[model samples]
Target: MESLFSTMIVLLLVSLSCFTSSEALKSNKGNITIKWDLISWTPDGYVATVTAYNYQKQRSIPSPGWTMSWSWTSKEVIWSIVGAQTTEQGDCSMYNENMPHSCSSKPTLVDLLPSTPFNQQIANCCKGGVLKPGLESAFQIAVGNAGDSVKTVRMPVNFMFTAPKQQYVCGPTKNVRPTRFITADKRRVTRALMTWNITCVFHKAT
Candidate 1:
């Protein structure tokens, strides 16, 4: 009876620790707060500070042809068809009237920076959990040119940290990137590791 009681006590302590090992992120710009229970999961290193991600995408995969595999149907992601868009390239050196190629078959998906009447909140544990300056400093993702007929564009959102990067690299290398990933209903997020490097700084309300 004493052994069983001790085990229960231990479990109780663990549970308490799980909930209390906490961290939070407060927007420097806005007063909104992002809370995290770091005990269950947290960043690699430790520091006491607040940080935030503007947004994050949960990644998941369904069985092949789970619901028309060709179409993007997973509801786990916050997707917007025909998002705001712009063109930075591919205007063609000059118009080709003879063979005016119709690349309109592909869907042009654009990712818009999160804007809310209220600020969007992200949960980063400690100072270490913070992402990049340009990420929080400036809009992380913006603009795409998907073709017509492809009414929907699969926006790239990834789980994990997006390390500060200046140039684009190919494939899943350990670093920050505009990711092309999907999240399923099961919540098994893919390792589309996106990261940002921001040293969490805390300021109390005056």
Candidate 2:
């Protein structure tokens, strides 16, 4: 009886360890949204691209219960890193280049600024493009030159957001007549959360 009880206790501890590896505690449940940043996926040597995707997690037993991952519309997100572990978010920016990083886990986000300054920062993110989302619409700029063909690129999160207020340039001086995107109930996200993974898909226009 003693040996059996010890074995049960060991099994219970192992089960708990696996469960905690990925934050699935009821208190840790948080909603996450995903959007793509086109040209901006400029990590080194990365190629192929993600067109569309939806995130899903294991809903049953193996106990990744609260864990999840995304399925992309295109298989373009994968890449080959000659010999390095991906060190940053945009490390996998190209279609045929090797992806140095993996999204199999949560994205690394220490670079993300808080809502206020980031909104203000967006005013200067893009130099040559026009944003279509109105003030409601935001744009992402790739770190790579639009014309670079054989180099690897990595995207930075700042590529996904801008601060609503103008400290630098790029902030609009006039209210846009029509907003680019409005929520189902007609509300646009606040300038605060506006950049939370704000996606600006790419169009290689010729």
Among all candidates shown, the one with the greatest lDDT: 2
Candidate 2 segments whose C-alpha is farther than 4 A from its true place: 1-4, 16-30, 34-36, 40-108, 111-120, 123-206
RMSD values, in order shown: 20.9, 17.2
Give one digit per residue, the lDDT tens place, for model 2 in 87-120.
3454344435533344322222211122334433
Q: TM-score, each model?
A: 0.19, 0.24
Question: Which ten contiguous residues of candidate 2 have the minimum total lDDT?
Answer: 58-67
Q: Give each model's clash number.
A: 18, 37
Give the Å error, residue 206, model 1: 30
Supply candidate 1's per-residue lDDT for 78: 12
